[model samples]
Target: MLGIFDDLAAGNLAGVTESLARDVIYENPAGEQYAALPDSGVWRGREAVVEAFRRRAQLVDVLELQQRDVVAEGDRALVVTYQRIRHLLTGAEAGYEASALLSLDDEGLVRYWRVLSESAAEADVFDSDLDERLLAAVRAGDSREVGALLRRGADPNHRETATGLTTLQTAAGLGEATVVAALVAAGGDVHSADSRAGGTALHKAVQRGDLRTIRVLVEAGAFVDAVAPTTGHTPLMDALWYKWPDVVAYLLERNAGLGLHTHYGFSLREHFEYELNVNTRGKDKLLVAEQLLQTRTREDERAAGEQRLMAAVTEGDQAAVRGLLASGAAVDERFPVLNGFNDLHTPLLVASRDGHTEIVRLLLDAGADVNATEPTFGAVPLHKAVYNGHADITRILVERPGIDLDFQGATNGYSPLHDALWHGYEECARVLMAAGARTDLVGHDGKTPLDVATESFGAEHPLVRELAALG
Candidate 1:
């Protein structure tokens, strides 16, 4: 019976099926989850049990198999063994202490087998002697020992003791240029992936902005376009995501492609644009990124330009806006894709929303339409200024000639007065009303500004009660 099981483990699926009794049954430890078995959810029957072992064998290259103990009772047998599972592609090894409850038929062939083993997380089959020595040398940056070990037939691509990372990947991640060079020189696979994260040395170098390590890996033939398994992000994408200009340039010079899609379906160009508009940096960084992005294809350049404009507007950087305009940035630039609404924001509306008095004045002086309504929100500069409680800017916009103070948002039908009252901006609300701003404007929900204030503040606060009383 034990010999039959050994034959099965050796990949011979011959006459063992016919020897199993038709009434055989198998049982496993409670709550054990086998990857091959259906969650239905326990193991049962003879053929189904054998199929499970076959599937497990398919995922691993078994280097060695050894049985530790065997106990037999009547027609049943229990066997414990250790199996080494090596990942065929990456050469990673994992071990499992396997226990099988087997029921044999009268003819000496296995009838049913149920395996209760430690879960995958507990499996580690790699030889520790080589791993411990290599990590010690690599971490101490002892190139001599590293070289000697490699020459002595130690695996150069062995992972670190702490992080389960390849020596080259760890060196690059830690910015250890000497160790990286040594490992590369010792025939370490530059394209070797970290055992845990599946990232190559180039990916770590790009992420840490380690220019020296990046160059080393690139020179050693590491794939600059290698993407992380977790993120599906290329090395170039990682650099762009983190705003690492030097890494980006190095990878690009090596022809690292940037058009790869992340797991989130965003390209490297899109990530840069999103960061440019969303990050809290000042105009200088945005401008620098814009200049770098301009070196890309025409479509990417145009997208970056639009993002630059959005950043300038969102951050209220008057100087950046002026400088971009002076450098021939298009004043009427709009986003390429808008689901339904057109993109019609002028610099005035941007400045007014962000409370930038100087930018608003500058855009107005630059002949921007003061009363132009945004296509999505449908609010002019005056409406946004009034709603956001920029009283000084609002006062300037409302008092300007030909600017309408009663403009409403197209989507929500919210007037500037409603917006101010809802957000507890008393001074802006009072100033708008004092300047002949309509107080009775209703939103899409059939509630006026005073009604909103009453509902929110319960008409208890002096200012809220006062606004409600004005109705």
Candidate 2:
């Protein structure tokens, strides 16, 4: 269907003659004011339509063609198109948009076609002053007028002819959220950079501490981490430089990248450090930026300490584990493992399973739960110690004063002693027995510790021998 225009521009009317009915009527707006262009009028029949377009082919040449929309209802269709064309006489190019209303005949050929718009190549598109009008409206904070201008065909990508400040940039710099939203909805380019700074509307929003406007821009798909070409700083780094953690916090929540630095070599934390070192200004507000960064650093450290606590336990580093606990790491955090399931558990649970005896004792002293079960199998730390044959950890756990020595596994219903003997850990079983672990506890298999041990070492198993001697 769009080939109609290409055919028209190329003076090849034969290809489109079949799609046009014998009695088709073509109407368009073109006039004497457009010198050398066809006057606004109507043409009846495919022959008249062919001649009319031939006149245009003689007057202008198409440079680029853009189709906006094509809607059809049954045999009728409407096509909205924008074209950039150069006048043959003046050798001047300009853009024009027109909507073509088309109606198909009984034979599926266009019987009635009309180009609806008063648009002219030179007048409507290069209206040179429309961009200034839109920018001024935004600068004056007139959202209503800004929207009116945009709806009336003001370019959303308008930039200051002098300073390269865009309409969206001006709205964002002024923190006018309504104007920003209106412009963005009108296809404003959020990524347009300030000519001087090479920063985008997002950077302007950050500099003004306008979180509301920032949010609007961000939601409109503004680049969260676009670096300024001049300074090589992102919006987040700009927020940090201004000492506006409130803005920084908002950007971070929007998933802005952390650890971004300036071209001068300073991270977010390093910037805070620089604030303290070369901060000879002695202003109260400057100190406030320092204080905010300090608080941010501490919060990040506390969160990192939680993961470090697990690493210390996993590596069996007793002192690191003790220091982390002393520094207020979570004593019973259920850490996730290989597949990101909450199968791994508290520092004490990890230390116990890995046979880090001193770390186990340290975590227990630091109030780590001695009997917290992992979510995967609901096995407690004592079960992990015995299953892994950490008899020393098992003994330390059994003497913890309130250890659940006979706590059954949620999956298999085995007590710590049953799990011990089932895994052939006679030493772990001995520790449980010395701690007064119940031997009469029945498991899911209807077997006791004596039954499980008899399978391991025949009748000479220690559990079997101990019970027989008691008899």
Candidate 3:
């Protein structure tokens, strides 16, 4: 199965065609539209299947199958695939969740091939001159061409049968306001559901973070609260996940639901907070926080402060870091109970782990304990800096008074030097050695730095020479 996927991804047609039986039955009931079209059908025989594929190449610029699962039982396999297509004629794109059942002969040739998909609306094998021209115009953002096509009797709401996407959906997804406005003026339906996940143009706009195109659709009577029937995702929820502040603000102004639970079972506020906490963009942190504040009730203030501080450290926002510290954020505040970090991280540990040298300096200057150990790993901030090969951070920690150079972490498994050697951090190892890191010290396994160095890179490597010189 993996070999078949590899062949398909690489466009190895011979590899694909050679594995099919001479009289194989390729039955695609969902592709009935293609049965009436030229050179397309429930192809029989290896020769007919190869010809069907040759015809398929005419309409597609790109075809990719993202494999999700493959379950095999003897000679039969049930395969789940996500199909992405870029049409050559329309220059439009579409994706579908597809399932296929295959029967392979004892000789490993495919004998019976059957397929099922979520919707027949996404069956895009049928093609015409007008359909391609209309979609190409829409995708290119050519408002004049789109208007011309509409006047010449093109369907303003014409959907790519394979992707279940209308011209408006593609325009909105691409953030083309001019094209969206042109289609809207020509009677495009803003609320039409797509075949894949039943998403409308508004959903696509929000998903793409296109404020301008979103406005055009909203003004054309697109619903702000419209949830995708398949995914149950509102445009607001999509905007929140993407960290689009302006989109979130606009949806809020339009009375979009704030506390709606996502498909993941978390409320919008919880998802926004998670996004804010994990985001590494400094400026975006503030914007997302402000959006959260606007939507958050007074009960969310306490947790909001901690999230803000953590976000600042995550982004290496020096100013926000100083401000949060000045405004009474605890220097050693613990990460929340369920934040998914393997260790309980303070701001200093987080900064050092992220290689934020300036933030690490700031946190240290603001009274962050350099030797403070994470509760889970029993590892200090310097251990993290060494593990991540932060040379500047290693220098900074070593320069500080009372800093432990050979602190054994987590039942004394790997000292900082041992970790540096094991992970091939030669520069950090050199820095640690220069800062009076003991060459005689061994880890819990009784292996010295030189032993680790010789084992990791052999005695001939430069690291062994450095560690030996330290002794």
Return the top candidate by lDDT.
2
Tens digits of per-residue lDDT for model 3 on 19-119? 88889887766443433233334779988877766666666643677888989999999989886766565566667787879988878889887775443
Q: Highest TM-score, which number? A: 2
Q: What are the lDDT scores of the predictions, listed in order? A: 0.69, 0.77, 0.76
| Clashes, model 3 | 1
Q: TM-scores for all candidates?
A: 0.35, 0.40, 0.36
* Candidate 2 error regions (>4 Å): 1-128, 243-245, 252-258, 272-282, 307-471
Q: Tell me the tens digit of each residue's lDDT in model 2 across 107-189.
A: 77888998777565554333334567788888899888787678767887877767678878888989998888998999999
Query: Candidate 1 — worst ten consecutive residues by lDDT sum?
Result: 31-40
Instruction: Give the better candidate number (2 or 3) by lDDT.
Output: 2
